[model samples]
Target: MTEALYLDNPYLELVEATVTAVGTDGGLYVDRSIFYPQGGGQPGDCGSIEWGTGLRTNIKNTVYSPDRSSIILIPRGDQDLPQLGQTIIQHIDWARRHALMRMHTAMHLLSVVLPYPVTGGQVGIEEGRLDFDLPEGETVERVSANDAINALIRADHAVTTEWISDDELVANPTLVKTMKVKPPTGAGRVRLVRIGADIDLQPCGGTHVKSTGEIGEVHIAKIENKGRINRRVRLRFGPSAESA
Candidate 1:
């Protein structure tokens, strides 16, 4: 099984690993990895791998195996492939990944403040968005949402993660109440992210900031009606709503 280093430490940008297997589809499977594969509304990591001999390959994208036991790395352009059992160094594009972490954390805060069910969401380097199923005749208020979310950011609440068994989670329904999207349980165990003592609690697998203040200033830039019940709210980091 591949060790997911990102789960324990999201800030780990570089790591040494051994190439365990090479797929016929030109994907490389490593023994351990810090790369965040594409899933849970967050994009996959983009980075490169370097062999000890000075040979390197650019990792274009990462995808999880069907059983989640390993991650497949697709190379970008033609490059010398590392042999199985060979030692290699993996480096993640920290600037982009850091932005995604901030955006992902901001989205969680948005879910906590906004009183609506989330329909969809996506994290990005430039901005992030969440579509919500709002109540009837409810108007979109960017200023109010922005103010509430920023207030929580200023609170500097600590973020922490915990593990809960499937049986235990099922026994406590209230523990999963704040989750915008229900986590897939049956995987043996689930990770619960707690923002503070009682500020916000949800099941998440994506990378996030250590505290709310690290999210900086997030502004609700736009709100559009995608359907009768779907309202998409876009967010970005800035002071002016128009610029964000």
Candidate 2:
């Protein structure tokens, strides 16, 4: 299995890894990876991998191998592939990843501001959105929700992560926020992301900033009606759409 360095240190921009194998279509499998594979509502990381002989491949995306053991780096069609067993230096597009982290953290704050069951969500580099299973006839005030989200960001709440056993998570089902996506449990442990002392706590395996303040200014771009009881709230970075 590949060591997922991103989970432990989301701030890491570069890493050294060994090319363990080459997959079909020029995918490079690495023994250790800082690139986050697409999962948990967050997209895969894209960057570059430099190998021996000074050759480098522009990684288009990152993903898990079949059976989900090692990480495979998908290079752009025009990039050259490194030979297996070669040591490679991996670099993350830190600016892009940081934006994703900030946006992801903002989504958590969105969940807190809305305080409703999350039906679905997605984290993006510049924008994020969460679909809430809100009751019919209830309305989310756009301006107020935007202000609330900004308040949390200015508060600079610390974001931390911890692990709990599957049994513990089962005992405290409230820690989960998503209705359709169950936390991966076969490993006997699940990762939890907590903001502030009690701002929000939920099972998440995506990358995040160290503090809410790093997210800077954010606001609700729009609230769309997806269903009779579903509200899709889109969050965007920088000032609120009205204020911007």
Candidate 3:
């Protein structure tokens, strides 16, 4: 089993790890990893690993092994695979991941700004979007949503994480906000992201900024009607198109 170091500290950029196994498809499985796998609407981390003889492998992407037991780091193109038990230092692209972290945390605030059931979402470094199920006759203006999220950002709400057993989560069903993407259960426990003392709380495995302040300036770029009750809100870093 690979120890996912990112879960403990998403800010960690590098760590020494031992290559535990190599797949036939040329993917490297390390004993530990800071690389986030592609899932939960977040793309996998991309970086490089260095080992003996000044050799390095550029990781093109990361994904879970079938059955989701281990994270396999796929090399860029046909790069040589690390030997089993080889010691190497894993490095994540901090610039890209930091943006992702900021965007992801901001999305949580977006859900709060709208306060609707999340139908779908995507987290990106440049932008993020959340599809919400709005109440009848309800509507969200881009400027209003942007202001609400920016208020939270300036408030600098503390972001924290904790774990609860599956049984505990069962007793509190409302803790879940996303309707389509269910939190991975049956692992005995679920990871929950809590913002501020009361701003938000929900089951999420995605990495996030340590505080809302780190998210910086963000704005609702657009709000599209996906259906009678579904509205897709897109968010971008920095000022919005209208403001720019």
Candidate 4:
């Protein structure tokens, strides 16, 4: 199994690791990796790997192996592959990753502002969105929800993470907000992200900023009706145009 350095330090931009194995399609497997594999509605990280006298390979995407035991760093189609046993430095695209972290953390706050069961979500660089399961006839006031989300961001609440046993999570089912995707269990433990002292707490494996203030100015760009009870709320970076 590859050591997932990002889980412990999302801010880690670069790391030196040994090439442990090579995939059938030229994907590089390192003993340790800072690249986050795509999961939990977040996209995989893209960056470069450097080794031996300025030799470098552009990594197009990161993902897990078939058995999910190791992280594979996929190189660009035309890029050269690092040989096994080679020592290389992995560099994550920090700017892109930081934006993702901020957007992901904001998604958590959106859950709090709406206080509805989450059905799905997608975190992006410039925007993030969450689908909520609202009762029929219930409606979200766009401007007010937008204001509330911004207020939380301006609050500068600290974001922290902790580990809980799978059994403990099972005991407290309410800690999970997403109805369709459940936290990965059977691994003996699950990771939970908490914002502020009590702003929000739930099982999440995605990366996030250190504080809500880092989320900066955010606004609800749109609220779309997906189904009878599914409401999709889109959040964009910066303030709403009307507020500007």
Candidate 5:
């Protein structure tokens, strides 16, 4: 099993790891990883791996093994695979990963501002979005929601995580906000992300900033109607063009 270093420290950008196995499709498996594999609406990480003899390989993406037991680092192309048991330094694209972290945390705040059941979502380096289940006759005012989100961002709520047993989560169903995506279970536990003291708490396995202040100036760029009751809110870094 690969030790997921990001779950403990999203700010970690580099670490020394040992190559344990090579996948059938040329993916490299490491004993431990700083890379965040693609899942839970967050994109996989991309970076480079440096080995002995000044050798390096560019990682295009990170993913999970078919059984979800191990993390796989996919090379950018047909790069040479590192030998098994080779010691290497894993380096994640810090700038890109940090941006995604900021956006991800901001999305959490967005859920608070809207306070609706989330139907879907996506986290990106420059922007992030959440689809809410808004009933007919209800609406989300862009200006108000935008101001509310920025207020929380300025308040600088501390972001933290904790583990709960699968049974505990099963009892407290209200802790879940997303109507479509459920937290992974069957491992006997689930990871919950909490913002501030009581601002928001939910099951999430994605990377996030340590504080909301890092999210900076974000605005609701657009709100689209996906269905009769689904409103997709798009969030972008910096102030909205109209406000700027």
Candidate 6:
């Protein structure tokens, strides 16, 4: 199994790892990685890998194995692939990852503050969005939602993660209450992200900021109604926004 370094410390942009295996298809697998694979509505990470020979190859994208057991690092262009068992160093594009981290955490806050089910979502370096399944007669006003989110951000609440066993999760159904998305179980343990004392709580594998204040001032740039229930809320960070 590949050790996902990002899970333990999202701020870690660089890490040393050994090439566990090299795929015949030209992909490379490392013993440990800081690269965030493309999944959970978040885009793949882009960076580079450096070998002992001082040769560095740019990573164009990252993906998970079919079984979600390992990560595949796709090189940007044709290059001499690193040999298996070779020591290599990995570096993540911190600017991009940091933005996504803040945007992702903001999304969780959005899920909690909005009185609707999330139909869909996406996280990007400059912007992020979440589509909510609204109830009839209820309209999601961008101004109101933006104001509420900023208010929470100003509160500077601490964000934390916890692990729960499968059986314990099954017994406490309320522990999984947030929206339609269920906490991942049968994986030995579940990771829960908690924001503040009673602000938001949900199962998430995505990286997030340590506090709500790190999200800065986010503005709801657009709100699109895709159907009777699905409404998309787009968020953007301004130039003066603080970094996480």
Per-candidate TM-scores read 0.93, 0.97, 0.98, 0.98, 0.98, 0.91
* Per-candidate local distance difference test: 0.86, 0.90, 0.93, 0.92, 0.93, 0.82
lDDT of 4 by residue, 112-226 (tens): 9999999999999998899999999999998988888888989899999999999999999999999999998988999999999999999998899999999899899999999
Q: After superposition, how far is residue 142 of candidate 2 from its true place, in Å?
A: 1.0
Q: For every candidate structure, what is the RMSD over all alpha carbons to the true structure, in angstroms?
A: 2.0, 1.0, 1.0, 0.8, 0.8, 3.1
Q: Give the distance in Å from residue 148's predicted Cα in candidate 4 to where it truly belongs.
A: 1.3
Candidate 3, residue 187: how far the Cα is off, in Å: 1.1
Model 4 lowest lDDT segment of ten: 60-69
| Residues 1-244, model 5: lDDT tens digits | 8999999899888999998998788899989999999999999999999988888899999999888879999998767768899999999999999999999999999999999999999999998999999978899999988899999999999999999999999999999999988999988999999999999999999999999998899999999999999999999999987789
Q: Is candidate 2 or candidate 5 better by TM-score?
A: 5
> What lDDT score goes with residue 18 in model 2?
93
Error of 6 at 43 (Å): 1.0
Best of the two (1, 2) by TM-score? 2
**Order by lDDT, highest first:** 5, 3, 4, 2, 1, 6
Residue-wise C-alpha lDDT for candidate 6, range 77-133, written one tens digit per residue: 778778889888898888888899999998888877785767678898888888887
Model 4 residue-pair collision total:
0
lDDT of 1 by residue, 179-227 (tens): 3667778878888888988888777888998999999998988889999
Q: Which residues of candidate 5, in runs, are more than 4 Å off?
A: none
Best by lDDT: 5
Worst 10 residues of 1 by lDDT: 174-183
Q: RMSD to the native, candidate 4? A: 0.8
In model 6, the Cα lDDT at residue 159 comes to 91
Which runs of model 1 end up more than 4 angstroms from their true locations?
A: 173-182, 242-244
Candidate 3: tens digits of C-alpha lDDT, residues 19-125: 88998888999888999999989999999999988888899899998878899999998676679999999989999999999999999999998899999999999
